[model samples]
Target: MKIDAAVCSSARLARDRRFDGRFFTAVKTTGIFCRPICPARPPLERNVTYFATAAEAANAGFRPCLRCRPDSAPGSPAWGLVSTTVQRALKLMRGEREPQSVERLAERLGVSSRYLRRLFAEHLGVSPLAVWQTERALFAFRLLRDTHLPIADIAYESGFNSLRRFNGVFKQIYQRTPSEVRREGHSSRVDVRAATPVRLYLDYRPPLDWQPLLAFLGARALTGVEQVEGEVYSRSFAVDTGDLVRYRGVMRVYNDAERNRLVVEIFGQEGGTGLYLLNQRLRRLFDLDTDIEEIQAILKEDTLLSSQLRENPGLRLPGAWDPFEYALRAILGQQISVAAASTIAGRLVTRYGESFVDDSGTEWFLFPQAEQLAEADFSDLGVTRTRAKTLREFVAATLDGRVNFAEQSLEDWCTQVTSLPGIGDWTAQYIAMRGLSMPDAFPASDLGILQALGSEGEKAKPKEALARAEQWRPWRAYGAILLWQSLKSGEQK
Candidate 1:
């Protein structure tokens, strides 16, 4: 995770978007850290320093640049590329109520607090607490600038215990009170409107293949729970923000190709934790944090993937909104076509999911809960006995915490789920790919891949497909995306 000075300087000087979230350039004289794509003139090499994360820069006493907005620069690619322990810790930190103490956080990560601190310091150059504080402060900063949400509401949503604490932290980090900063921003910029239809953008690396990614999700979108209309993907979500209080809302996501960012519009008013959770889920849904250049560089070495990589740049693995819902879809998809699976999933949702209406009067349903699905009768859903049994077992495991998706390695989760009835290597690997966001989880036994890589009138064996996939290590999930996209172009024949 060490930053190469010369490489970072070059990227900064050139304003490379590829390195946008990978590193930040902090100006010694200005006491500000900016994203690599920041538009400000580059500073002297002597006055510049690089940081792996905004928290690290903030830890070094540098405030975020007002113009560049580092918080919206996409997540650090290191989260997906670093150690499993760091990955799990980061996943936990991104949750609504993160572990307040390093001891508690370490316990959840199954590592000693000292070792966990070492990992954070080594990779992020900051303590776990510093990272969490910076995250909360930056999110509050964003809400203050971008939306007209009341200051008190902003404080609560940003994880502050009281107005006093929120103001203290804001002043401590940015050297100004929240109201003062907002006033200065307002005076400096044009008139701003209210926070209606609260709009935000999630940045991603370039060359995004929006058409195929949308098509993939659009084709399989379930009714009464999710929809993909043309370029936008919309869904209803329910989050338990502690105390058994369920915050429900609808989110609309679509690509903003001109800006190289995904535009997310939340059509309901749920406070800061809801925004935080929605952001995490949306990032997972679009796989926005992926380093496409790195993935493609490795994947292009494979002969079969080379042509596809050239044909489709910036291809990404589409992720699920919720792991449990995705697992259910995968269970329904076992030995069935994607179309058939979608139909059955839609019916299952309509029957078991909760009904609600958004601010726009769009009737939506929350995807069925684990306990609800576990005890529900699935026989009438037209699913075979084996598939129904597999789904029930999956839900039962989820409800009882047997099939956990929290902070576990992809291999562990895959193995844990595959141990259930009717879930095999393909289903497990597919779940790992989309459910756990494991970039290397390739389903070599998939018939589409077999046909895509095979010769005329013959299909490749699973062993052969896996052997051929070795070169695609660490990015086989994206390779799977390429193969599936090729199927749309009639190249699988």
Candidate 2:
């Protein structure tokens, strides 16, 4: 994946957004590194050094170029490489992340700490601890740059132990104090409205199918918890802190001219309350953090369904807001239209979930967890005794970790979800791809999708339909999204 030195120099000269975040260019004269898309004039070729990751550049004694604000460059899209270990590690870190040893975390990912460390080094060129630390620290750094929260509150919100540690890490990583960084920010953004609707810019790759994707979410959106306007979507979040946070936000999707990233702006929060969660949630939903180029390369040459390749090549199937909630929704979706399934899901949450309101008048139920749902008896809910029993088993399995997708490989999650009573191949594969973060998981048995792919060649049978999709190997999931959209335009929701 290394680039030619000359090519890197040319990319910097052109300020090409395509190369931004792919590599960092350090100026020997100034001892500073910046994204390739930095607006500053290119430096002498002989005096520059290019590194793959920010840490690598910073570790070699180069400070960040203040003009470009290297921290603002989009995060790398994690993909392609058999990164199951990486995905599993992120899940473990995000959920119940304890201030414990990496050894224990590694054990949870079913790999030795040393093996996990090597994986990080191999893919990201940093230790696993460094990756986790950077994820938190950089997020905190962005908050400091964007919001006016006090240092102590920022530390707690950023998942740091104390102000001292936060300051120390901030100085070490950015070569400056957090306050100093904030003070230096040039807030000339013309319409920089930071109140009520907190605006934060998030970036991603290009060629997104914004209209179709938004249309789908708009139709399926729950009544009280979510809203959609054109290409923008907003919702209420029950922060893990158990606080009800509301945000009035609209995302304008566009290719980042500077970072070659997909930039998203979230506005309408007084204190930037849920900006961090919004960033994570948007990353999952819009799938901005995916290596689509790598994925397209894998499925492009397959002979079976090559013609389907041209159908909205940049499609992204949105992921869930909550994993447990998504799992329950998948279970209820069996043999039902998406609209009907969504209605059932909304009812289940409203009836049994916790309710709260935010300042923005947004209301939501804290989606019941595995333990909570496991204890509930859904017999009188109008669903069959079979669906009720299925719900029971599903909840119990999640609570007991018997059906844990956190440790399971993509294949394992797909197989395990189907093994549950109500979940079949389509539902299981959908969960695996979206809920379990399995990129290669695709539900070939999907009826609507198969028909949308022009499967009814007047005489083709179900077996032929499966055979037709043989070429979409590994990334048939992308095609599934397009077919879903096709159905949507016809008001099939």
Candidate 3:
């Protein structure tokens, strides 16, 4: 990744929040890398060097700045801007329990290890392993700062094989031992028990349209499985450790707007690794890694979206908690209103979903797993016979390895998914947009989108809508979100 020194210098001096995770400032004199929004006095231009990723800076022998905590910054929005291959690789890497060998990872991505290494080198100025190592070390560091987990537990949870290795990695990256960092953090140690909830924060770039985002989730929230009360969004989650052990819990997230982060409180038996996976899921669920400004710049070119862009400056694409669950919801929602889909979904959950009561005595239901719904009947849940068959087939495909949520090109994934019976362009594109977090995925056939693009109270035909959306290519998903938001705003007025 090429970094324009002059541009970085200006942003560094200005402490621009927009540039926070886009790049990191490595000060040669201090041998430390900091976020662009670091509050420390700006370093002289001569001592400053910019790296497109914190991993690059760490590989360059720079320690993370204690003051700014680069690990806590939003993920680099610039990551996927240039290479989709790199983007896919990253998504895979973040969700892995242990970093796979380059050969294995490349095979999953349909690329040779050599070519994958070259792509990482060209786009991130680092090897894939270096990126993985940095991510692991930083995640452990975050655990140190945010939770009271024992250092040993943090080690295993952060994917370190042993306490010594964890210490060595922390020393190499942060120039401090895990114990030192924890002590410096000054958070009182609390015994982590199965029932005790752990609190953590997930940060994002500013101008987040938080309340509206919550409202969007609240409207589509499945009863018992999800609850959105006031400004808080809470849900029950189940994390399969891939080792035959599954952990269940409830998590609540609310905005900390003043600090530009969300406070996540987890009540579960998951250790570090499970929490790590949950973090990734929540980040995707809220679309926290997006650079809204950069996306808006492209979508604003469309006259249809421009007004909504101004009205909802930091609108985010709300993502699914689980791809399979959301895909089922989309299937249930075919030719139905949002409320109707949600009602059916809630009934499905009540039927097949696992039930648990938290310490507060509040009952919560986990979204039904594929196995649970595979042989189950949905006819009694108010689902039409055709829709019920589609749901069962979708679950069967998921179980038979016909539908994978793994890393793949959006077009390929869409083609593979739409091949199934009853799933069409709109459903596939909708899944791609939210389920797969594919930004360019757009459902041109969507009623709401067509209505929003239509003029004088006439709905645009899907063909016309598709043609008009051509200009929004590579960002059509955000365009879709803008159109939907605009439609909602119109209804309210």
Candidate 4:
């Protein structure tokens, strides 16, 4: 993550949004840190210091800038490319109830606290606890500026245990009282009422191909569970508690093109915990945190893929909202068309999914759980007997804990999944690509990829296609997405 000073300086001077999350700048003279895309006056080169993360700048005793709000900047791409332990830790930190201590966090990652701190220091230039505190502070800063929530509520919502601690931390970081900071820049505040949806911006690197991604999701969206209309992508979800309780809600996310960021509005829940978790889910679902430039650098080296890459530079490999649900959809879609699978999925939901009604008068359903789907009859869902057997086995395995979506490495998950009935290399790889968020999980046997890579009028064998795709190592999934889009775009011509 060591960025060249001259290059960082140039990005800062130009106020480049492209480099927004790649790094942060701290001014020694002003004692303030800002995003690379900050709009305020640029500091002198001698007074400027670059940091790979906001946590690092904060660790160096620099307060966040009031105008730029480094906390709201797009997350660093380093999170995507880091080691598995760090990646898992990052995901866990986003949970509503995070681990109590660095030791606990390390225990979750199966590493000692010392080693965990070493890894964080190496990659993030800050301790894990510092990173967590910085996240809380910044999230609080965003709430203070955007909403009319009570300062006390904002404190607890931002992970502070008490009002005194929240106030002290705010002053320590921003050098101002929370109320004062809010009042200083409260002109654009929204009058947040008790029932209002919590709205926030999730920033990302530019050049997102929103249309193609929407089209892909729209075709496969299950009725009552998910919807994609025009620019908005909305879904109903449920989180099962340990004691047989479940919290249900609906989320809506869409692009604010003028702001160069995605706007996420969470309804049916008002706590910061739900808001934080939903934001993480949406970021993953949209693949917003991917380093497209790094992927494109590898992909463009392939002469065969160069043209497709040029045509859709911003194409992203979409991830799943719920990995289990998506894995079931993948099974249902084994060899069928997307539309056919979606229709059957809708029927399956109607038969077994839990129902809920939103405030907007739209009826919604949560995707069925493994326990419910295991014994359910799929005969009426428009699937063949063999496909039905496959799904039943899949559900049974999931219920029996033979198939786990979490706590398993990507390689192990792929191996275990391929062992199931009706699941093959292609389906397993597809699951890994979307469900497990493996950037390199390329399903070379996919028809779209084979069709896109054929020679003249001859289709390539799966083995040959896989061999040819070796050049796209570590980013073959991105190449697969671009290739798939090429076929879809070609069909419209």
Candidate 5:
């Protein structure tokens, strides 16, 4: 997590958007840490110190800057460069409820608490508990500033056990009580019972090729379950909140390219941790946390990928909204055109998915869960018998816990997934790249990738493509995306 102070100083002085979340500038005089892109006047270099993460800054007794709101910055790139253990730990924490204790988290990770703590300390410069608390506090602070949710509800939603603890942590980190901070930001309070969509904004690093990303989603968008209109992408979601409770809702994401953020509108009966989970999913779906510059630096070294990289500078690896859903989609897509696969997927949703009607009487379909389709018949949905059998077996394996989406290592996960019947390297690699958010997962056998790498209207063999992709190690997923974009731009032979 070491940072170059000179580089940080220059980024801070230039208000560089690319370095927004890579590091934080902690001011000695103000005792506040700001994003590198903060609008506030530059502080003296002597008064500024750089921290690799906001948690590290908070651990050093520096408050988050109200102006820059470091919490809202794209996730620190340092998270991507950490050890596999830390990466898995972070994924688990962000994907679900925080484990009750470091012991519990360590147990789940199959490592001892002492070892897990050491990894966190070495990489993050903070304990696991510190990271968890900082995340919760910062999430609550964002809610206070952006939403009308009551303080108590915000506390519960943000993972705080009680209002007292929430206030204490809020004050400890932000140097102000929750109410005081809310008032200072002048956020209007509203009734908790009101049936209004909760709106929130997520920030990302700049040079986002937003239209291309949207086009990618729209092409494969499942009918009735997802819709893309104009610049907005909307979909229906069903998030399980345990105890047989589920929050079903529709969320629409709008591109705010001018501001370098996406404005998300959530239409649902809001209360509970579902909103928090939804936020994480949306961030992944958009791949907002990736460091485009870093990925480009490596890919641009090759002539083939370099041309595509220059054509689409800020292209991103589009992620899945749900792993199970995307895995099913991948299975459905095997050896078929994208349009044909999407047509069958739409039929599957129409048959097995749940219907949700919003206040406007507009009906939407929620993608079916594993249990919903475990034993269900898909023969009538224009699916081949072989594909149906594969789908059934995949769902059964998922239900029986043989296929875990939360697995840590990409190689191990891919191996386990490919072991399942009819699921090959391509499906597993696609799942890893988009579903699991593994940056290194590359499907060398992908037709589009092979075609993009070929010459004179010829497609390269999988072996040739894999060989050429060796130079893009640890970022082959992004390379795959660039290749796909090249096909769209007619840059490929």
Candidate 6:
């Protein structure tokens, strides 16, 4: 918590939103901690203490201020900080799939458990497990606030092992019974804005160009599974738990105009685990929370991506509707166009995926899981043996726990996928960018990227493309998207 005394003092004086998640001001006199952007009166400098997270502040006995829900604050931009391990860990905790253990996570992080523990303590001001617990409780809190499910069902839906445990923990932290929280919403209506109606608020950063985004998804729309019209993008899937969930949601900018959070209004069964799984996938798919401003500034220096950045700065590489499906499409469309890759993906989903009906429409099965694909032979599927082996290996790894996609660092994930025969840098990176939601990942060796750069204002060599991409910094993945879009446009003209 490197607090510059000057910055803290100024933020308190101005109540700046930019400093919101950087630190919290715990007022010793009033027993309250406030975000720098809190609407309340500021406390004296002598009576203040600073903490990094709401959990850490609460750990010190400061009650939450009602006016400002610290929990609702956008998550820390920690993706730009620390190793990818902590961010990856948070994703798993949301799904409750990967067991949460610091020692076990430490093993995966390639550092001793001791060093990883120290990293969390030093950087996040809390233990690794503490972050996971807070995430689960909050998820449960949101579900309880927004839904009308029975308590027993809500408990399990929020990833609690038992109803009793859920009650005890919710009561312990919120200082009230779960019933109280439910009662508060009973006055008029539950915030039933969208679960059954299939409307959801998806959050994202500002300066988004929605037309291009929708056009990209609309053109590549798959039959019976996905649709994109105007600002609405709806999709259906069967979750890992074999429950059918359909989400026909609308995307909206969050209320706090400065924040990048998209509020997704999900319409589904209150106890359904599938929507939770869908949120995990959608955040990566739309990638609205990404910081493209920083990315474009970096790419402005490079000749190849510079003009493209000017044209389509917010363009995001459309991520996979299904990871396995995306991997197959990537392999099958190796030398083809984006439209071709998308067509292949649609064929694979229609053939191998299932069908379910919801109010939104007929939702098709999610991309078949590893168990279904591992037994599938590609000889008759119109894919090559090498591609078949790569696809099968992906399926096998997921089933055997070698490629548990939910909870591993991007580097670890890429290494695991690349270790399979016939998967190289290109395939590995394509998977990393889409399959794993790795934003910084850049698949630069693509023939299209090479050709775009090579034929551009200043001719760049194929091998030099990687070096040229280095200037894009943490946003090379976005640059890759723009370059690809530029190539397609240039060819059409």
* TM-score for each candidate, following the candidate numbering: 0.95, 0.85, 0.96, 0.92, 0.96, 0.81
Tens-place lDDT digits, model 5, residues 1-493 = 8989999999999998889899999999999999998999999999989999999999999999999898798888899889989988887787764335889889999999999999999999999888988887888888888877778878877877678988998899998999997777653554655736787889898888888888888888898889899899999898875547788888899988898999988887566347677788888999998888889888999987889877788878889999999999988888888888899999999899999789889989998999999878788888789888889888989999998887578889888888987889998898899888789999999988988888998999999988988999889998898888778543310
Candidate 3, 132: how far from true, in Å?
A: 0.7
Better model by TM-score, 2 or 4? 4
Quantify all predictions' global Cα lDDT against the true fold: 0.82, 0.66, 0.86, 0.81, 0.86, 0.63
Give Cα distance to truth, residue 301, candidate 5, Å: 1.5
- Candidate 5: pairs in clash: none
* lDDT minimum window of 10 residues, candidate 5: 484-493
Instruction: Quote the lDDT for 430 in model 5.
Output: 89
True lDDT of residue 17, candidate 4: 81
How displaced is residue 337 in candidate 3, in Å? 0.8
Candidate 1 stretches with Cα past 4 Å from truth are: 186-194, 270-273, 488-493
Query: Cα lDDT for residue 114, model 6?
Result: 87
Residue-level lDDT tens digits of model 6 in 280-321: 566567765465656666878877677876777666656765
lDDT of 2 at 291: 64
Candidate 5 segments exceeding 4 Å error: 187-195, 488-493
Native-to-model Cα distance after best TM-score fit, residue 188 in candidate 1, in Å: 13
Using alpha carbons, what is the TM-score of model 3? 0.96
TM-score of 5: 0.96
Candidate 1 lDDT over 407-482, as tens digits, reads 7866787789888888999998998898778888989899898877788859889999888888888788888888
Return the lDDT, model 4, position 218.
Answer: 80
